[model samples]
Target: MSDPNDWDFFVGLGLALSSNLFIGSSFIIKKKALLTLQQYGVRAGAGGHGYLRQWLWWAGLITMGVGESANFVAYAFAPAAVVTPLGALSIVITAILSSKYLNERLNILGKIGCILCILGSTVILLHVPKSEEVENFEDFIIKIQNFGFISYVFILIILNIYIAFYYGPAHGKDNLIVYIILCSTIGSLTVMSCKGLGLALKDTIYRKKILTTMILQVSTTLTTSVS
Candidate 1:
């Protein structure tokens, strides 16, 4: 008989792949809807909220929400190491779809980049760690509370604050690195907190501790991500 845990892992892997499909398609859908709206009103880039009136825009948002929900749930069944890397697949999907639907050119370099992303994701999936250092909610709590991890989180927070308030305002429009750094710092925190929230939700479902530990973990995860 197959190990039940193995089954859960496969389910997580499937969900992760499906989530990428939804999310990637959402980008194209939203862009197309925005373009449609621009034909009738001011472009979004020029300060227009007309896309809000389009049903396609709302559908894209719903699709994105579904994808994100699947991704979060996948984290509960698989290690963050596995689920996080799969996010690259979304870029591959977006590139392919954009070429077909949005008339975006997928030149030689773009095609090579997508191939590299798929190869990287395949390598990661084939060699996923068999053991998790933090397997349960209790272990997760201990991991996050470690001094080294806390220090790293604090450093990221400080950098994000400094960049957003100081450096970004001055040179963000001219230098793409400003936003890249900002997103990287915040994205790291968001990924960890999202995994924590997934674990918390799983614990609540299986152990029926929704009122106590789940609530606390959920609040902590939200606070951490927002900060």
Candidate 2:
């Protein structure tokens, strides 16, 4: 296992940037589609998933899927640290699109804040370490079984359960941040599962051991389902 060459690195970067663009645009488009649904159909907050019937919503979803696919491939060739910070660009893009297309207002302070975020992301990207290729499934398993990682996963589970049973009913409806916290916490686990699955698939393709890869694939699937 070796570091990706310069060409692979740049290709991944380009894919990530493209994903940011598509994802950002999808946000605005989806919002518009939702608004359209709200005008003639039940709101999503009222237990309606009627947005599914809208072609615009479907288009937005397809765009988002494309973006995620690009992001998935990007991770194969680049470090998560490098690719993850680049996601801030999606926020910047969303803000700009929301203002232009959705008529959402951005105050001067907000503009300044967005600029600062971009600058911070750029600095992080510049200094981020490259990804080290894992040699095999055994090494990946060892890494996953680290005490610190296990503890972190345990804490996340406990917190997620607590939030679902206690904080969610009390404050989730009134507070947007509650759902954001839930998504962020659960998303960490999901991302880990996806990364493992991606690596396993890559290894399986390289090694051509179908039986072992099948087992790894099943385990990864179960991990994702459990999470």
Q: Which one wins on lDDT?
A: 1
Candidate 1 off by > 4 Å: 165-175, 211-227
The estimated TM-scores of all candidates read 0.86, 0.76
Per-residue lDDT of 155-191 in model 2, one digit per residue for the tens? Answer: 9999999998999999999999998999888877766
The residue pairs in collision within model 1 are none
Error of 2 at 175 (Å): 7.2
Assess the local accuracy of residue 178 in candidate 2 as a C-alpha lDDT between 0 and 100. Answer: 92
Residue 113 in model 1: lDDT = 91
lDDT of 2 at 136: 52
lDDT of each: 0.84, 0.78
Error of 2 at 203 (Å): 2.1
